[model samples]
Each structure stands twice: as structure tokens, then as C-alpha cells.
Target chain A: MVKAKIYVQLKASVLDPQGKAVTTSLHAIGYERVADTRISKYIEIIFDETDLAAVDTQVHSICDKLLANPNTEHYHFELETME
Target chain B: MRVSVITFPGSNCDQDALEVFETRGHTVHSIWHKDTDLQNPDLVILPGGFSYGDYLRCGALARFSPIVKEVVAHAQRGGYLWGICNGFQILTETGLLPGTLLMNNTLQFICQHQYIRIETANTPYTHGLRVGTALDIPIAHKEGNYFIDEPGLRELQDQDRIVFRYCDADGNIAPGTNPNGALDDIAGICNTTRNILGMMPHPERAATDSVSSNDGKQIFRALEDYFTTRA
Candidate 1:
């Protein structure tokens, strides 16, 4: 089995509305120094595979083809063999 | 054509998306998020709303929904998908779409008639739109601002993968015109193939002239037009 963890985020050029809102609320509550607030997701996948490299490619392809939109998203994966 | 609008428990736009599809002469199905069977539709849409009450962040919890499992499978087979607002967030959560929708730079619950520029109109969803044209769509969200890393955004821009940018009515680059303060006024985007389009604006809300600026109709028209041409 191979386990892969994925991190996904919006591109920098796009505005992060939710993060900004949270920051605003913080400011309203007197936490005025909060410079930034951005949101993101962490995805973990475990699948059985014989070839680690092949599964690694599969993980990336999954992220590329479906998991993440390369245009507006950035995805990084950490893959390791499961004991 | 058949279109399925996914209904998450907190989803607010399922009906809106369905209504637009119906208006366009396509059969629209309201598929709940709990159902595993996709029923094999021509297209699937994740409508906007606060799914799972936006627990663990917007669209994050819904990414593990029963339906998303099947949605991922269908996408693997080259299925077409679309996401708007929270729907776009869910797609990001499920790793089906690209980019993360972060907090707005200014942090406000903005509800405004925003603008979007068509950077690339080649995809099935954007095919009918002319290059460099603009769409005046309404964007109502608390977390519609979009963000990505430097290298990643540059790659998309370099490949013309950057499809839609937020713009003024005249479609010029100006601050404050961007409702969410997105970098480059990016309001929407698509995958490399353009099969999947995720945007912040509510095209369904503006599909009718009576209620809106009528710019929303063009997005639906573009998708339907492309579907017709290919099918």
C-alpha cells in the first residue's frame, strides 16, 4: 500500500474571500493585527499498488486530472510506502 | 442533453442551476450528495452553497460525501463537471478541481454584480464566448476570493490555462472592481482541457434578463452551444 498526502490551494492571483472575512471578524473583535487569513485543504489517500513509482504517477495524475485544477490550483504530494 | 445538479444538504444553488439547465432545454436532475450512483448524466454540476455548514472550512467536509466518490470515478472516465461558489469549493476539496478559494483580501461578505473577462474560451464550458470579451455576473459570497502560488499561477497564465479574469464593465484591470480582491482580478478558472470550470460568479442567478444583467445567460449558452457542437 502507498499513502499520499495532497495539499491544495487557490492561486495567488485570485482573491481569498473567506480568509479575508475571517480576518475582518478578528479585527472587529480587537485582534486587529491579523495581517492575513487564508484557507486550504489537506487530502490523504492510501491505495494498494505494486510499483511505487507508478502509484506516484497515478497520484499526480489524479490530482492533475481531477483532484486539482492546475490553472487556479497548486497541488503538492508526499508519497510513501505503507508497512 | 441531461444535466445533474448536485444537492448538498446546505447547497443553495441546486435549484438555480437546475432552473437554468431546464430553461436551456436540457433535462436537469437534482442529485443529492448522499447518493453514490451518478445515474450516468451528460454533465454534473456542484452548485453553490454552504455544504456541511462549511465545516472544517468551506466545501472541505463535503469532499468526503458519498456522492463525491462516484463523481471522482466519473471524472476519471473523462466526464464533464462544473462548480460555482461552494460547488467550486467542494470540487477543490474533492481534488476534482484546481486552486483553493481563500478568504477575501479585504474580508467582507460581498454581494455585487461583478465582471469577468474571458481569457480563454476554448473549453466546452466557455467555447461559445469570444476571446477577450467580458461577462457581468453577480458574485455573492463570504469566501469567493481565490489564491494560488507564484509558480503555479505563472504556469497557468503561460499556457493560457487562465480562463476567466474579474473585470470592470468595460473589462479593464482596476482595483475595487474586483469584488473579492483576487490577484489579477481572477474571477474564474478551468482545468487544462477546460472540461471543468470553477468560478465565483453566479451565472445561474443572472440567466434571466428580468432579474439580472442578462450576462449569466451567455455562460449557459456557451456550454450548451459547445455540447451541441460536440454531440
Candidate 2:
């Protein structure tokens, strides 16, 4: 079995209103020296595949189709085999 | 039937939308930002504009407006809605729609003509158009790029919710043909139910008789026809 971790976030140039709002609130609450902020989601899963290429393909298919919206968000995945 | 167009203090396209519906013989009402109780419009339109001065983020401030809350509720009940440009931003901000709008990869505002493919023309918002057809519409925005994660992107495609896409003048979805560089050259998409449409391109902007404006007339005509037929 192989485990995967996916980190997703809005592209660098994309506007993050929710993240900005939180930053504003933090600043108001006296969190100084904070220069930037962003928000993203993480997902983890286990796939029972021995072929590395097949596992990669399946993981990419899931992300490109559902886990992320490539138009606004970008995602990278990390995988490791179960011991 | 009555159509409601919500107007924020900073909204730029409210009048254009209002005129289009009025010409179609539908009663049009302009709702203010502070009114939480919507007059319950049969059709609601969130026009394109830099609402709330694009503060914090595009459509971010407007998403919290009293009018938006009611609009969100109306959509949940299977109400018909059309969001263009800034309205699209508001929809994402309010969580009424999936996927978020990000800044242009160029980090600059873009205003120009674009070719969008009709990915799914079966919805109330796109019924008049046929699948895989090409449309030439104008899109203007600083943040118009769409993004989603792996699982989420798949779910969107699997559900057949994609409605519009940027393509060549011939309606081809290719890499170099996109004006906004959207994923799959996506110009617009709908909720899983295919009732709520959020698109960055301004169909209303293309409805005018002035050069290059009437391209969006088909979209409005489709809606007008649907309402009349149901009535």
C-alpha cells in the first residue's frame, strides 16, 4: 500500500479574500510583523498499488479532476509505501 | 416575471444588466447592498463590477452584503441565477459556488475579447447554445483565473457541471487559444445541479448594439425564452 499527501492552494497571482480577511483580523488583534498570508487544504489517502507509475497516474487523476481546480489552485503530491 | 439585479456601491455593470432585461419585457429591480430580505425575484443576476472597491479581495466584501445572503438562499432553493465577472467572485466568496477566482497569472487587469467553448449547453442558463459550440465574449478582470485541487477538479468534470470554456474563435479548446488561460480554458461553470451559473465573462456586456456587444445576447435570450415557456 502507498500513502499520499496532497497540498492545495490558490495560485500565487490569485486573490485570496478569505485569507486576507483573517490576516486583517489578526492584525487588528495585535499580531504585528505579519507580512503575508494564504490558506490551503490538505488531503491524505492510501492506495494499494505496487506499480509506481500506476499509483502516480491515479493520484494525479484524482487531483486534476476533483481534489483541485487547476484554474485557480495548484497541487503537489508526496507518496510513500507502507512498511 | 421579475428579474432582480443586485447593485453594490461600486458595481459598474448594474445598469447594463438592468437595461437588457427591461428591453426583454421583464420587470427589473435593482436591490441595494443592505437589504437582507430579497423581494424574491424569479431570476437574480449578480452583474460585473469591482464591488466594495475590490477590497480585501475581489467580491470578498460584497459577499457579506445583506443582499448576497438572500441571493444565496434563493439559489439553494433551486432558484435560477447568473453571475458575471465580479458576481462570479462573490459566488465563490460566499461558498455558493465551488472553485475560486485568482489573480491573472500576469498580475494585471485584462480587458479584451475571448473565445469560450460551450462545454454544456443543457442548463437553463445555456440551453439555447449547443455543446462544443464556440462563443466570442468579452471578459475583463484582474482576478479571473479558476483553480481547484485534484479530487475537486475530478468531481467537477465527473458531474458534468462545466458550462463554458475559453477557446479559439472557432470554439476549439486549445492551449494557445485562451485569452484568460483558464484550466481546460474554462470560461464558466455551474453547480452540480446545473442551476447556478458563475462565469467571469460578462454576457450582459456583450448584449449591446454597440460594436461587439451583442455576442452575449444569445445567453440572455435563452433565459428569457425559458421563463416565458415555463409561464
Local accuracy of candidate 1 as per-residue lDDT tens digits, B1-231: 788888988999889889888977888788988898877888899998889887656887787789998887777777788889998887766766556776676566788888888888778777868877878888888877676677767877887777788877787767667777566677777777667778888989998756858888877888778888888
Q: List the candidate 1 regions with Cα displacement exceeding 4 Å.
A: A1-83
Cα TM-score per model: 0.75, 0.73
Encode model 2's per-residue lDDT on A1-83: one tens digit a residue. 88888888878866666677677878999996677789887889888777778888998998875566555778998888887
For candidate 1, the TM-score is 0.75
lDDT score, residue B180, model 1? Answer: 71
Clashes of each: 34, 30
DockQ score for model 2 = 0.08
- DockQ of all candidates, in order? 0.25, 0.08
Q: Distance from true position, residue B231, model 2, in Å?
A: 3.1
Residue B89, candidate 2: alpha-carbon lDDT: 85
List candidate 2 stretches off by more than 4 Å.
A1-83
- Model 2 CAPRI rating: incorrect
Residue A17 displacement (Å), model 2: 17
